[model samples]
Target: CSSCKESLEDQCSSINNEDNSTINNLKEKLSLISNFQEINLEKSLTLAAEVGTALLQENDELRQQLHLTKFEKSFSELELEDQLEESSKKIEKLINEAN
Candidate 1:
């Protein structure tokens, strides 16, 4: 009877140890998952920020290009007007000389 009792006790202790080991492994896995989730969140935010910055820079470049185009168009119109005035003056002088 005493030997039987010892055998049962040993079995119970072994089962408890196995359960504890399983519980520890699950806890570690849970912690690792939580850390991974946090890291993923950080990476997502960083990527979003980088994309936003790139878009902003692109918009600024487009605005500058549009401004330069407008300036050039205005300059060309002014130059054409000046040339037209000079031609009109020349024609008037030629007619006066003929008369």
Candidate 2:
């Protein structure tokens, strides 16, 4: 009975050692995962900042293009109005000469 008890105690000690080792290994893996997650988060933030800057620049460029288009449209409309007025005046002169 004494030998049986000794055998069970040795087995329990071995199992405890294995459990401690497994626990330590799991902790190390968890630490590595946490480090990787931190690095990924930093990279994601950097990328997001870069994308935001690019979008702002694009928005400014689009706004400038829209302003230029509006100016051109206004200039073209004024030119067309002037040409129409000149043509009407010429028609009036022709009608007066014919009368």
For each candidate, what TM-score against the reference?
Answer: 0.56, 0.60
C-alpha lDDT (0 to 100) for residue 36 of candidate 2 = 68
Q: Rate the local accuracy (lDDT) of all candidates.
A: 0.64, 0.64
- The alpha-carbon deviation from the true structure for residue 19 of candidate 1, after best TM-score superposition, in angstroms, is 60
Clashing pairs in 1: none
TM-score of 2: 0.60
Which runs in model 2 stand beyond 4 Å of their true positions? 1-39
Task: Report the alpha-carbon TM-score of model 1 versus the true structure.
Answer: 0.56
Give the alpha carbon lDDT tens digit for every residue of 1-99 in model 2: 346446555655665565556556656655665676366676567655655665565566556556655765676688799999999999999999999
Q: Compute the lDDT of residue 71 as modeled in candidate 1.
A: 60
Candidate 2 worst ten-residue window by lDDT: 1-10
